[model samples]
Target: MDTQQLEKETLEKIDQIVKNNPVVIFMKGTPQMPSCGFSARAAQALIDTGENFGFVNVLADPAVFEFLPKYQDWPTFPQIYIDGELVGGCDITLELAESGELKKMMAEANAKHAQQDA
Candidate 1:
């Protein structure tokens, strides 16, 4: 498939992901067993926030690896998205945690999702 088709497919999958799960994490692996150090750290940050989230293992899909970078325009793995928006990788998550912003964002996200569910 062409780049356009691949991009479209990747984004559509991502959209479905975020829509189905309130908090979606497109990281290296499952939250229980992250494939990389960055992914593990990102998961930890999310855990610290005390919110449950969904995770997609890009390592499990070759197409996802080939197409995800183009979708996010980010040359890295362990990408985290909140409410369907990219929130950078492990370093950004660590920074947010150190500043206590990660927890705050998680709380806000949880509240927003709770409102939607209600």
Candidate 2:
């Protein structure tokens, strides 16, 4: 496919992933083996929340890494989304985690998504 078409498809896939999952993290790697410190820390924060989350490993997909920032206006890896909304990167996630807000937010998001699914 052409460059534009490829980018369009990538963006659409990203949109679907973000919308379909209530809690999604677009990071450098998988939750078990993050590619960067930021990703590791961010993934840990989410894991601590005890809420199941979806992740996209940017390192595995060049098109997503190149075009996802435009999709959510987040210009970095380890971007967390709750209810399909950007929740910022590592620092923000850590802050929320420390404040005990991350768990709550994640739970609420999961619950809301579960309701939607049901």
Candidate 3:
């Protein structure tokens, strides 16, 4: 495939991942082994919520790492999405986690998605 086509396909795959999952994080690595401190903290924050979530390891996918910031207009790693919405990065996630809002938000997003799926 051509460069443009490859990028297009990657974007589509990202779109599907975001839309299909109730909670998703695009970080430098997986939740178990984050590549960066920011990614680790963000993933931990989500994990603290006790909700099941999906993740994309940017380090493993060059196209996603190159195109995600442009796609979401968020120029950073460890981007978190709740119900297909950009919920910001590490600091924001940590703040939400500390405030007890992250868990509530995760539950609500999960419930909403579950209803949609049902």
Candidate 4:
């Protein structure tokens, strides 16, 4: 596929991901093995919430890596999406985690997913 086509496809994939998953992190790697420090901390915050979240390894997908910033107008890694909304990056996530808001948001999203599934 051409670069533009690939970017389109990757952007679609990103949209589907954030929309379908209540909580998702677009980071450098998986939660289990984050490639960047920012990614590691952000993933850890989600993990600490004791809620399951989806993730995309931007490093593994060059199209996504290149297109993601433009997708949200956020120039950073470890972008968190909650209920299909951009929730910012590492520091913001850390603040949310510290404030105990992250857990609540995750729980609400999980519950919403559960209700939809049921």
Candidate 5:
């Protein structure tokens, strides 16, 4: 496939990833024990907000590992999304946490997700 086709495919896969789970977390490891400091921080940010989230360890999925960067246009581990919208990476999450905005965002997202699930 050409670059454009590859990019499109990557985006479709990412969209499916988010749609498959209401509170999906694309991190370096499971929430219980994150493999990287950034992933740990992001995981904590979600927990700190009292949001129950699902995780995907890119370390475990070759296709996800290869395409995540193309999907997000960001070459980094521990990317986060809220209801399929790319919220940001670790630093942005941390900043939101420190500012007390993370909780509000997560709470709202959680409630929205809960409604959808009902």
Candidate 6:
């Protein structure tokens, strides 16, 4: 496939991943070893919520890293998605964490998915 086709496929893959997971973070690295400080903080906030979340290491995949911003017109790393929605980057995540809203959102998403599974 051509480069354009590859990028389109990558975008589609990103969409599918987001849809399939209740909470997902697309960051510079893994939550366990974030390469960016912003990503580290963002991932930690999610972790502090005591909720399970999926993470995609943008650094591990160039196509994904390049195409992610286009996914939602978001021009940043450590993009967090909740219930297939863009919840912004590190700063917003931190704010949510401080307000305890992150935990609630995560809980609700998990419950929603769990109900579907059941």
lDDT of each: 0.81, 0.93, 0.94, 0.94, 0.81, 0.96
In the range 21-99, model 1's lDDT, one tens digit per residue, is 6667778888889888999999988988888788889989777877778777888988877776788888998998899
lDDT of 3 by residue, 15-56 (tens): 999999999999998999999999999999999889989999
Q: Residues 1-118, candidate 4: write the lDDT tens digits.
A: 8988888898898899888999999999899989999999999999999998999999998888999998899999989999889999999999999999999999999899889989
Please give me the total number of clashing residue pairs in predicted model 4. Answer: 0
Q: How many residue pairs of model 1 clash at the backbone?
A: 0
Per-residue alpha-carbon lDDT of model 2 for 1-118, expressed as tens digits? 9889999999999999989998999999899999899999999999988899999999999999999988978888889999988999999999999999999999999999999889
TM-score of 4: 0.95
lDDT order of candidates, top first: 6, 3, 4, 2, 1, 5
Model 2 spans > 4 angstroms off: none
Stretches off by above 4 angstroms in model 5 are 1-11
- Kindly list the per-residue Cα lDDT of model 5 for residues 7-38, writing each as its tens digit: 67767877887875656778888889799999
C-alpha RMSD for every candidate: 1.8, 0.8, 0.9, 0.9, 2.6, 0.6
Candidate No. with top lDDT? 6
Predicted model with the maximum TM-score = 6
The estimated TM-scores of all candidates read: 0.87, 0.96, 0.95, 0.95, 0.83, 0.98
Compared with the true structure, the alpha-carbon lDDT of candidate 2 equals: 0.93
- Our tally of clashes for model 6 stands at 0
User: Given candidate 2, what's the lDDT at residue 60?
Assistant: 95
Candidate 4 stretches greater than 4 Å from native: none
